[model samples]
Target: MGGNHAATGAAAWIAVTASTPIAFGWYPVSDASVFTGALVCAGAALLPDADHHSGTIANSLRPVSNVVVKGIEAVSGGHRKGTHSILGIAVFTAIAWALSLLSIDTGDALFGAILIGPGIMCVLLVAFALKALKITRDTKLLPWTMSVTLAVLIAIFAPEEWYWMPFSVALGCTVHIVGDLITTNGVPLLWPLKFRSPYWMRNKRGLELDWMWRAGGNLSLPILGDAGSVREWIFLIPVSLYAVTGIVWALLDQMGYDTMAIWYQIVAALPF
Candidate 1:
């Protein structure tokens, strides 16, 4: 689930960025923004899982993470409850937005470009994303090092604009929820606002839509049957390919390669 969510996050970011070779132009495009936003999205994709005490994000740090996980679990009314809901997305985005504002008052950057608040946010979140992606599971040092290095680079070279940061967080979380909706257990997307199941939903044998009302509206589609199922893996193939392709294309374009021309050549060379 973490891997799938992470890939989806990157793909979602690529889909929104105009700077990428295959995307729309919702936000202003830049080499730095493109990559930074993708990483942020990947990290935020795993953010909702913090509610699960035994999940990846819970043990992401150590004792501190455990305490934080317990707090979130309690406040969120257990896993797949508040943190998986629309309200949770709003709360997460608001927090990210607030941290982004901290950069505005920073007359002197941390390293000539790094804003303390956003820089710290990026470091922690990006580190979490690296952890969730299992980029270096054998040792935690690598991810932390990579995150710090990226943060410093962003501070030094990336632009100061972060208007798109909070929304990226929101999009990542929403993508996570969507991922859950495809699973058999589903998620309470509308926490604390359960409704009676309609005739169609009530008649379904496996899904207890009305029964789950107390926990929240457990809106699910069950297309993938269950988490980590073989069907899920099959579904992830195309998504993973898209994420990889977008990332590679973005990087190539950043390195000044003519991606469009290459894509055209690739198409032309393909067998009919």
Candidate 2:
């Protein structure tokens, strides 16, 4: 589910950035920004699940992650409750926006030399992404190192505008909610306000259903049955591929490679 969430997050970012009719071209950022935002979004996709003590993100680190998870669990009113809500998304976006303003360059040598603001944010995000994607499994060291390296590279070469941070966070978190909404256990999008199950979904005999409704219950489509179901895989695989292809295409386009021209040449050479 973590991997699936990450994939959806990346795919959503790509889709939103794409200049297509379906996307509406909301974010007209540079190719580099799109690529960077996609990675950040991928990691943030798993952030809402931090309320689950046993989740991959909660267990990714040691005492720190455990402590954070406990805190989130306590505040969010258990797993899949508050952290999966609209309020949670707002909070996350606000925090990201605040951090985006913390960058320092020039005058302050310490801040200028070190990747303080968005750098740290990017490091953590990319690290979590690597962990969630299983690219740095069995050890946290590799993810940390890779994250730091990418952060450093971004600080050196990428543009300084951190305006996209909040958007990426919001998109990632929202996509996460959408992903969970399709599972057997749905997320509470509008928390702090309980919702009764629609008459058709009500189960009079089950105390669990009653409790869920009372605790600002879940909102689900349940098309995937459960997390990591075959349906989820079937849906996510193509999305992940689309994200990868978009990233590659963006990079190539940035390098001034006209893919359309190559495609036309290939088509012309092909047999009719």
Which candidate tops TM-score? 1
Per-candidate TM-scores read 0.87, 0.85
Reference-based lDDT, each prediction: 0.76, 0.77
RMSD of each: 3.2, 4.0
Report the C-alpha displacement of residue 20, candidate 2, in angstroms. 6.8
Model 2 residue pairs with clashes:
none
Q: Which stretches of candidate 2 lie over 4 Å from their true place?
A: 20-24, 61-63, 108-115, 159-161, 198-216, 263-272
- Candidate 2 lDDT over 1-272, as tens digits, reads 88888888888888888553324467867777767778888988888988888887775655567798899899999888888999999988888888777755655544354335777778767766777889887685677678888887877555364568788889999999888887877777888777767654455454345323423367777878788889999998789998897777677777889866775887799999
Name the 10 consecutive residues with the lowest summed lDDT in model 2: 207-216
Measured by TM-score, how close is model 1 to the native structure?
0.87
